[model samples]
Target: MAASVGRGAPAAGPEAGGALWAEVWALLPGTEEGLTLALSGEVDDCVRPLLRRARGLLYGAEGRPGEEAAAAALRRLGDVLRDYSWEKLNAGPWREISKAWRQVYTYGCLFGALAEVAAGRPLAPAVRLCDMGLLMGASVLDNVLARLVRVLQQHLPREQRRGAAGLAAESVRTEPRPAPAVRPEDALPRLRCPSLEHFRDNYLIPQKPVVLEGIMDHWPCMRKWSVDYFCQVAGCRTVPVELGTRYTDEEWSQKLMTVGDFISQYIVNENSMGYLAQHQLFDQIPELKEDISIPDYCCLGEGEEEHITINAWFGPEGTISPLHQDPQQNFLAQVFGRKYIRLYSPQDSENLYPHESQILHNTSQVDVEDPDLVKFPNFRKAAFQSCILMPGQVLFIPVKYWHYVRSLDVSFSVSFWWS
Candidate 1:
């Protein structure tokens, strides 16, 4: 991902130079957080000395060295911070470990960003450095790197960015998925951008699922999001890709890789199943967030737009989400390709055979499409509604409703969850 700055870009100009020598130079000092923030044990011990060394670099104390000296020292500290956090990520619980480590990663990005600017590096690699911090850190350096990313992207030559997914999208084999062995009793009702009152009265109050049409045609994402677009916009940024048949499998695991690497190995070659599921990618890559607008229907819930949770679901055909239920209302909007979804009411919870484990209690143990009927006989009695959600459509899933999803084509869907 950290390919050379000259890899795919043209010559840099004066405006880019100002971003380097002026705005970015001013922002770097603010990232000197190690001196103020206190961590426990060996981690604190690691950060303290880095701060002491970097103090003179950012603070401009008496006899502080030139920009080259600052760049050299900061780059070394950045490398150590990144490696320290990386070791912790592989050693402990993801959620708990990522907390303090992300703060460490933030400093790494800060140091890396300052180093890139001081050295007058080209825009492409510099943009990737900013992206690493944005994607992997907590408490980002006051959105400074995000702003830098936007500025650098503007200067990148437009000719290199692909308008559509191109050959990668074209290469998807259109193998039709066979019919579900446990078919739905009925199809979910389809509506064309119904009014708030109508949707609330008919579906929301009753907590029923519905397939929505005419709502997503206006979203720029429908036309703009594709493999090539991601390759251009976020090719160098790392993302967590889920591997194996499904999450329920004993073999399931996650690996971090660049977006370009994920596309090449999974989306194009189809050698492995790598799903980038349930990620807040919009916050990480703000440029991509501009393509889609939140639906008016989300306003029906409290906090309206602010309360909504956005997640990106991108993977090749055959990725499966075993039966599960969420606690909030969801609008699953298909930006491209198709997905087969089936839903069961909360009243059928007993029949759905939810896992007994405390962590997986919301998820059903039974596979909806290929049920082991002899082992779970009650699953046969579970009534369900189904849909093959298409592009330019959104599926409304009520809270606590058991649902399963499978990709029918190379797919990209943005899900919005609200209480």
Candidate 2:
């Protein structure tokens, strides 16, 4: 018979409304203290060897004995069930509780008669009966897992939820500001390509922003890592975050899966995010010393042209960079499509109504289109710099300059920084 319960079924009713836990409890001896201890300890010890084997098998590691594979998988599943029990005992945040319950609800049905049998007094016959078929039974495990994840995510802070929703929203209604003249002082110095001595003397010490468009033009990624190439070479590594509109739980799942896939599958995300900080890759590229790395598909090319990088492929309308500033001077290069950037200078801090704290002073309030002048009257006079970065164009953003970025189309970019 099928195992697993549906929500809204009265827990007090006969058969407990198909509840998996109810079935397990029904098969067990009375829930006495001695029985609880015996069951918990036996489950813990009996499952250890299986867990060890399963851990190695799941990751495709070598050296696990062939005979141990089934035991290992079973042990891992048992551990998951054990944790589910503990979760109920220690209820804290709704999300944490929901997650634990969800795991049990989805995977419990798959555990089959073993879940019921194990909860009961251990018998010789029960031991012999436990087999692979017990685990293969269809259960509501995956569905329950999905629902729980959604419930937990929906509990995010209202502001954060709003911000996340705006990720894919249509661009602001205000007309684009007129382009500013690119004065020589505003341009990054045209130093000889790779040496740090020149970059420091010209750009770093003085805090100048420069566009190094031609420098990395030859990097393999510059030409090959387009959306099509990414989907082909990397496969679903780019996430689809909601930059503008509210996302259903299903939409959020798609976004998260895509983001997680990108991070797990790509070397660029790993390397750029400092996962390989001590590896030979860093030794080969000196430009990365000052770049604050983010976990995304950022890469450094070989040869003297290696640049510290932060990159992401935005799908449809993707992650909109909330208005914030980084610590280091920036060299943001657009390699595909277009990205809109709005900038506010550090000198204009008073008019920008910077927060009192030194570290977070660069962050700006939302609702930029309509500011409450009574609270921050000076915001109206704040000087603004704006640009729409196109493929092969790089924009220099000095430290502490407030910036809000929007992907104009499916886009990708490489951003580098140096002290």
Best by lDDT: 1
For candidate 1, lDDT tens digit of each residue in 209-303? 99999988988887788777787776655667898768888899998776767777888877788898755578878877899888888878877
* Each prediction's TM-score versus the true structure: 0.82, 0.45
Best candidate, TM-score: 1
- Candidate 1 lands at a TM-score of 0.82
Candidate 2 segments exceeding 4 Å error: 1-198, 236-255, 259-313, 317-319, 355-362, 366-375, 417-419
The TM-score obtained by model 2 is: 0.45
Give lDDT per model, in order. 0.73, 0.40
Clashes of each: 0, 17
